[model samples]
Target: MKRTALSAAILLATSPALADTPNTDDAQTLETVQVTASRIAQTVDETLASVTIIDREEIERLQPQQFTDLLEGRAGIETSQNSAFGKTSSVYTRGTSSDHTLLLIDGVRMGSATTGGASWQFLPPEEIERVEIVRGPRTSIYGSDAIGGVVQVFTREGRKGPPKVDAFVGGGSFNTWETGVGVAGGTENTNYSLSVSHFETDGINVQDGVGDEDRDGYDNTSLATKVSHRLDNGIEVFGSILYSEGESEFDSTEGDDYTDYVHAAIRAGLRLRLTDRWDTELSVSHSRDENDRYTDGSFASQYDTKRDSVDWLNEIFLTDHLLLTAGLDAREDRIDVDDPGFLGAEEYAETSRYNVGGFGILQADLGRHLLEGSLRYDDNEQFGSKTTGQMAWGIQVAEAWRLRASYGTAFKAPTFNELYHPDIGFFRGNPDLDPEESETFELGARYSVEPGYLDVSIFETRVDNLIAGFAPPENVEEARIRGLEIEGGYERGQWLSRASLTLLDAEDRETGNELPRRSPVTARFDLDRQFQRFSAGGSVIAKSRSYNDRNNDIRLSGYGLVNLRASYQIAPEWQLQASVKNVFDKDYETALGYNQPGRAAFVKLRYQQR
Candidate 1:
């Protein structure tokens, strides 16, 4: 019944008489511009990659307190939620592992070399102005860690005008409460924004015998600041600092885990028109991250790591139809892990890893055809050297149709934990692990209908030497994965709808066993409508059953979850919003052994002015 309703809505959206004057502020046209698809910003209609952008208004519409929640329902995307407030969530793309994707903040890499992945919990929603997601390999533009794709989060700091403050507070089920406040303002030459938020909850019960305290809960606090200064001669300097801390209890153990993390970055750039018909820019940035994890009581385990890096990028326009870009990046990481109970006495292990890479990309256009190619070379102190490449092309087949195709190669180095962790525990890192590599191919087309738009893509990726750890005795090894994604959306005036479906088939060629944690099928649908002073929407996510552990010890039964939201504009500057998540109180889990929230509601009020 719901599927029928969704289909009917799509059909009605493409019918005649649905026209409404395009409001530039709330509507999406065919010529919308996006920057993450390509290193150089270009109109989305003219770009050659699969990309998605969530602006601040839409982010507010969903009322997601954290930025990570906003990314879960998109195409070629997957999110794992453990408990309500305590667990750190992870994302996957195109059936790829979490570590295969890269996370960036205003072009600064936030991934940790020690973990070979990102701890995304530190990012709070209030400070984000927008999020750009580019799907597929991005070796040409982003270099390493761009295997699956790149997610760039831009903060809200460069607003125009006098000082202003934005704040929100809300409460929901399971004793959940949230509060956030931020301030931003700018002059002709300077701008800055600072924000802080807190989230806490008394989680629900997953098992009958498990006490509410056993299911436990989590508390998270985050603070972030972004600032920029403009100088004479088209030069600018910018800096940002982010800090977050989380404390939460475990389900089985009567203990808690605490994590403290920080990220800081600064950049300086000079943009100049070198000559007539020629333009160029040079920029340099430095970034660092420090992270520490601690556990309480008898199960105490500790890890600390730090990363420092620098990057230089140069771009030039040689002609109207051609552009060139070159860049070099380097990073060094130091990690220290302590085993309080090891080999009669406590032992400490330390490791250092360094990575350096150079990249180049070329873009050219000839009439209705556009071509792009990118290449990168990286040298790792522990894994030796590897080179990755990508090529893409776009063609205007008809006045209303555009076609695009791309192919690329990506590689991932071994993580510090994978190389040095103890061999007798639940997880034993393989010291002789090799780098993993894969080749991905994608084809897509987009058509502009009278009142809306339609887009479809088919993709396949083959991975080799996939790094994964198995049970005791059997350590980490490699595997392969292949998948397909279908996504479409339509919006006509007050009504908007979107859907994404993914099918994956992956296996371990070595053992001929099905890959663990690979969900066979997943899909999501979101529908929304706006009428004069009020708007309402709802979404449904369906995931297929899959295993929870690498050794296939646990299994999770897939299910469908629903969410609904509504908002009313009382005045031009004042509004009220409310939302209900997990409407049916479904008992489900995205991660094995961990419980999730059920039947929650949140109400909020907001004020804004230009």
Candidate 2:
């Protein structure tokens, strides 16, 4: 049975010990600053939102083949893959809609304007240096699509020193192969980093009762780069680019169905110190997601989505412990589809829209007490005008414990496909759909020590104007979600461990049924030990049953999985890594019809110039 890892999770949860990163990597968490939650950098202890940080070291240590692999079941997060690798995946944060969560790349918004969600599979994990996951709502600071939370992907940063090069090659079951190389260096005033990678695999038969029995496949090529320079007058200039192109085959009931896609993002910014007590920054960014569909090796359709954005922000230090921030944001979304006209128009409706927003925040730090307040106003071309705000307060309840409470409001604009899609034979677009709006109430408590830390959060969110997929999509549904999350991590001597447990009660208010694909109870545990030049680790993830439909009639059974990894150093700067996923070969499904990967093994050779 899968009792070994499952028993460990139970022991960790009952032992009153560790969720955050392990002490070795998280000891300085309180000193680290994060920008996603507040739209302004603030120390971890000062952020009222529940946050998690995954840095490069942890990314390498985990040996994840997919970027979304790093996010499964962390805190209030859950992900369901339609099939295996390179397939459609949905990530739900705190029982909210998949599109409710916003994805940001290096402070720039990214995702499909048509589909309303980011293509997590195409995002190259090799180019990522760190990730910040903030739980709960942040719409007051970031505007739309913040109803769930925010996940920010930060690319590898350049260093000022001698040039260093690193490379890795690996392969695994399913005929998979991956390789990547990177180099970084620069002068004292300027730095640059560049990386390129490729991955391909003969994937699995993605569905049951499928028309095509052949194994589907996928391939991708990606590149990432960043450059930054500082002037003598305290001015700075920076830019970054990320690009990926891939082809994937999937089971579509129709024979020989596949897709070719290209996704890219670019951002450039300027930073200036206007005065000793005041600062300003201006940034502009653009991203594109395009896909071409084919059947029987013949082109069938095309969807190209693009987004352009600009932002201006200013910060003023009013007093020793008080700060004020103001910002303006503007964005435009455009999409082109090769299809019939919409609403009897001449041709496919070439659609576009724009949004503008302004926001302000004030923060105060008074010894053991902290306070924060923010407000924002957004005007969408379709939705007109809307306002949102939040207020939070935190205090040190004891020498090693802290308590916090916050209330926030957020909204989600309708996607292009939902608002203005062309005629697609089966369904028509709904142009009069209203935006979804939500409010959340959250309370949290934390305990920290030299060896470990633990935090607990309880929150309830009510969403109105939920857009449901019907004959034509409509905003006639509402939802209420209440949940509790407990996460902790500990590092002592050569051993490290982290664990998280989430309990959710998500309800579709209209139908009086549980939200689809939302598991009631989920828990995860990870343990590792380092011995000189060698290290070993294992992880366990367990989840309770969930429904495939909103009515809660079709039940997906509960399951548990175990994964093991180990690495050995061969020289001063060379190493070998190996991992076995789903060690027990458990039969499971995060989604009803999709087939999940099972019993996979991999090995990697790594080299770096130190």
Best by lDDT: 2
Pairs that collide, model 1: none
TM-score computed on alpha carbons, candidate 2: 0.94
Root-mean-square deviation of every model: 7.6, 7.4
User: Per-residue CA lDDT of candidate 1, range 286-307, in tens?
Assistant: 5554555455544444455666
Residue-level lDDT of model 2, residues 156-227, one tens digit each, is 766667888989999999999999999988787777889999999998888877758888888889898888
Off by over 4 Å in 1: 1-28, 205-215, 255-299, 341-350, 422-431, 470-478, 549-554
Q: Which ten residues in a row have the lowest lDDT in candidate 1?
A: 12-21
The lDDT of each candidate is 0.67, 0.82
True lDDT of residue 550, candidate 2: 84
lDDT of 1: 0.67
